[model samples]
Target: MTLSPDEIITVTLWGVPINATLLFTWIVMAVLTGASMLITRNLRPDVPPNRWRTALEVVVQGIQNQIAEIAQGPSRHLLSFVGTLFLFVAGSNLLLVIPGFRPPTSSLSTTTALALSVLVAVPLFGISRRGVGGYLQSYLRPSPVMLPFNIIAEASRGISLAIRLYGNIMSGAVIAAILLSVAPFFFPVVMDLLGLLTGMIQAYIFAILATVYISSATAPQTLSSPQKDAQ
Candidate 1:
């Protein structure tokens, strides 16, 4: 069995090889884009909300609430970034039930890209909220001597996010493959259900961690205010 989607090349054009990872990533993006367009095409105050709109609202509202609770501030700014991350990861994993489908997230390259996006986003959000100088000064908190450690910590966050997601998704795929060979009957259904649950949980955890990291950079005082108030 192939270890990652990157290993499975689906096509080549002008010496450029397109792997399963790239193929499925584009597929996921296309699906999301088409769905959004369809759902919002008739969005009008005068028209009654359809089931699709209602479901979308519930999902968006849940994400907004989670961001507000974690960031302890307005969630509008973070919603788009965080929501996209959650949906992409969740969509990729959930689609694993499809026969012959390989989740792009099972590839380390894809996970690393996602994590790197979060890494870049944290600083952009930070600078946007606190300004470049202020965001830079966060490294010097308590003492200037701690700057090196803070910088290391910042870099490690992306590595950790990438490894955590890649390991979990890849391991799940490995386990399911092993089970399929050992007991072809009954295990497939069980593994599919378990994989669905695992995918959703991983997506939630990833999004929440990204939110926490961005919130710390964007609003450190707001993050700690609850503790200060309690004490």
Candidate 2:
């Protein structure tokens, strides 16, 4: 059985080859972009909203509220990035129900890329809000001796994010595959349904953890307030 979508090569670009993970990632991006354009094309503030628009608004509002609770600064600044992260991961997983479609997130490369994005975002948001000097100073807070540990901690968070996502999604896919071989019927259906629910929960967790990281990095009192924000 194929353990990763990366095993399915799609094309070769120069000497490097593209895999199922890249193909699926592109597919997800296209779908998301098209959906966004369609959703907003006929948007009118004066007229009563349609069911699709209302549902879209509800989801956006929910993301905004979650960001506000986790992050100290204005949530509007974060809405696009955080919301996209949740939607992309959730959407990719939800599409698993389609026959022959693979979730790119089930690949380590994809999960690693996602984790790296969060890793980069934390510092960028921190630098944007706190300025380079202030953000740099955060590493030395509480005591100068803690600097190495602080740096290690920062790096470790990214590793944790990548492994948590990769392990969960890969395990679910593996378990479903094993069950399909063993029973080839009713059991696989139940596993797929459970995977759908698990995928949504993982998306929430990954997004929220990222939100907390960004919130902590952007907050004025980084050392002190992050503890509470995490809680």
Candidate 3:
């Protein structure tokens, strides 16, 4: 049984093979992009809403609320990137119900890319909120001797995030496959349902962890504020 979508080669560019992971990632992105365009095309401010619009609003609002809570009021600046991560991941996993479809997130390469996005984003958001100097100074906090450890910790953070997501999604797929092969019946259906729940949870966890990392990067600025105590 194929464990990673990276093994299923679909296309190649100049002898560098492209696999299902990359194909599905593009498919998911295209689907999401098309859906968003369709959903918002005729949007009106005061219309009695349709089901699609209502559901979309609920999801957007929920993401906004989560970002507000986790990032502590930086939701506006982060909604696009953070919200897209959640939506992409959740949508990828949720597509398992479709036959012959595999989630790209099951591949370490894909998960690593996602985690690296967060890795880069943490610093960028930090510098945007604080300054480049403040973000860099975080590594030497309390003493310069801690810089090496802090740097190691930052690198490990990306690895952990990638492994955590890849392991969970890949394991779930394996379990479901084993059950399906053995029984070819009811248990697989149940597993699919459970997988759906697990996928959503993983998506939320990934997004929240990202928010926490960015929040930490931005924390020094807030703490250094003289008026922070009064507010």
Q: Pick the candidate with the highest TM-score.
A: 1
**Each prediction's whole-model lDDT (CA):** 0.93, 0.89, 0.90
Which candidate number would show the highest lDDT if scored against the true structure?
1
- lDDT (10s digit) by residue, model 2, range 62-160: 999999988865778888888999999999998888887898889888889999999999999999989999999899888889999999999999999
Per-residue lDDT of model 1, residues 26-68, tens digit only = 9889988899899988999998999999999999999999999
Worst 10 residues of 1 by lDDT: 219-228
Q: Which candidate, 1 or 3, has the higher lDDT?
A: 1
lDDT of 3 by residue, 1-231 (tens): 888999999989999998999999999999999999888887978767788888999999998999888876656888888899999999999988887888999999999999999999989999998898988999987789999999999989999999999999988988888888988878867987898999999999999998888888887543456586667
Quote the lDDT for 115 in model 3. Answer: 99
Ranking by lDDT: 1, 3, 2
| Model 3 pairs in collision | none
Which prediction has more favorable lDDT, 2 or 3? 3
List candidate 1 stretches off by more than 4 Å: 220-231
Model 1, TM vs. native? 0.94
